[model samples]
Target: MKTKESKKKRTEIQAVDLFCGVGGLTHGLILGGVKVVAGVDLDSICRFPYEANNAAAFIEQDVKTLSGKTVRKLFSERGLKLLAGCAPCQPFSTYSRGGRKSGINEDWELVASFGRLVREVQPDLVTMENVPQVEQHPVFQEFLSDLHGYHVSWSVVECSSIGVPQTRKRLVLFASKFGPEGLSISESNRRKVTVKDAIAHLRPVVAGQADKKDPLHIAPRLSDLNMKRIKASRPGGTWRDWHPSMRAACHRKVSGDTYPSVYGRMEWNQPGPTMTTQCFGYGNGRFGHPEQDRAITLREAAMLQTFPVGYRFLKKDEKAKFSLLGRLIGNAVPVRLGEVIAETLKSHVAFYASAEKRECA
Candidate 1:
């Protein structure tokens, strides 16, 4: 009865996800008991998975053009309005910014547009998650300034501490009209989830082989040279372990020799490395399967990101493309990370609602 009561109270908090990519965050929030009303994203390909996996409507329009009143109308059904998003991180991410400054380019404007909607709608609560490098930009300061009416709490979150199976760091921000005490993220007490914990159930498939039972379990075909390289690769080993004859020409270069994460394999007992847009490729990062002589498949990557094993990245009869699936799964906010954020929000609302009840009594 107590669990049922808490779930009912959690339903009082409603949300709309901005820049919602294939509904990863929305799914996690729903799993955490938050009622996610709708998700908005420019990618039409996301529609099937987003709406199919979550009860939320997938709004397929560029957020840069979306009006706040339009969003407010979506929230008019009457619950505590919560606006959530992780603006596409290309402009703010350290890996891809290419020396670009904030508040100047069209990419950076997306973050500004996020701020615009917050100011216009004045939702009761707001949250944003992105790469840690975003904290250095001036536009981030401006976005922070937009929250003058709300108490905001933010920090660089070590995602693995909160049950995510990856060694990823994110800048998480929580703002609320309720008060300051409930705005912080809380890490779970569970032991760190690891690569073995996440994907060991998957049946072994060699490179270029697709599982008959699951289509998305397919690994991309490896080139002849790369095939030999992966065969020689040890679990948790880098290119440095490769015999000099099999090393990439770049790996033999002075600067490249120092860089070792690429062409590496994940350790079974440890958390996986941060996932990236190119995560499907074996040489892209530490993406090789620990014992299998193939790159980690799309299914493995998504699982490492804490998406359910049964997640539908493609529709029935739709062929899976490595590049497209990689981008969608990699760019998604880790489902476990989103779960922690949702848990934080739920606990916050319960505390304040209880306080109000006591005061009224």
Candidate 2:
């Protein structure tokens, strides 16, 4: 039953993750059977977590300044190579749509810089993930044009459809020197995961308190008035349900009526809202807990992103700092989504290998 091509395809595939924030993608890819040798990011805070969790080297250099030769040298002794770059998505995020700058920002240039490295290294495979709106930018167009040597497949992926317990959408691109037709990720077709499915089991904590057993379960202190407001807030309801005295001045205005997601509690049966850099704050989006009078904790947010409960974001002796931990958890690519990408790539490689063997015979 063993085909020579299938056996050949079993050779190890090694990868380097660019812009690897806290190693979410790296961890998922490893679960999908890729040997991730290293990760690159500019944030010094990520160094400990990235290395500690994945057992991979972390490079603190900015990708814009990173040379392809330097990256290639890192993979000199590896087998098949993969280059994964998930550039920062702030420039194209839906939250900033109305006031979005017309021209390129430093973040946009990082996409181009990632493309330049692809051209330089010409690795066996390449993958990228970012906000879906990025597809509209000329920078994305330029990056695609640079991939003439590889076959590319891209689509806007709905995170919930792929087992993430959040309603987040992102653009994902897969390119390979192998060929075009073999790269699409099949739809997961499973039941969508819900908020209760992800985090309802955690011990409850009140406003401004931490679960004594888990430091990361700490909530930010709330003002007395804010505490009253949260107690009145209903799951899936907006400020419209609040008493006249409790409503913020802006919510009483016509312009603020449309922003209903703010100061709302999540519905346990549905997927949570997209986690953002400020997700730990109760005032940000629908981050308030369905029943508790506080926002979700750092550990709860991480679990929603599909990170393992044991995933170490802070050192053993390090105290959990809200802002830093929030940024890391909120900005992460969900680990389940990364696993999907890796599985797709593995299938693509196997398909091509089988085809090549048939042609030779």
List TM-scores for all candidates, in order: 0.93, 0.93
Off by over 4 Å in 2: 1-11, 76-78, 91-104
The top-ranked prediction according to lDDT is: 1
Clashing pairs in 1: none
Model 1 TM-score relative to the real fold: 0.93
Error of 2 at 133 (Å): 1.3
Clashes of 1: 0
Q: What is the RMSD of candidate 2?
A: 3.6
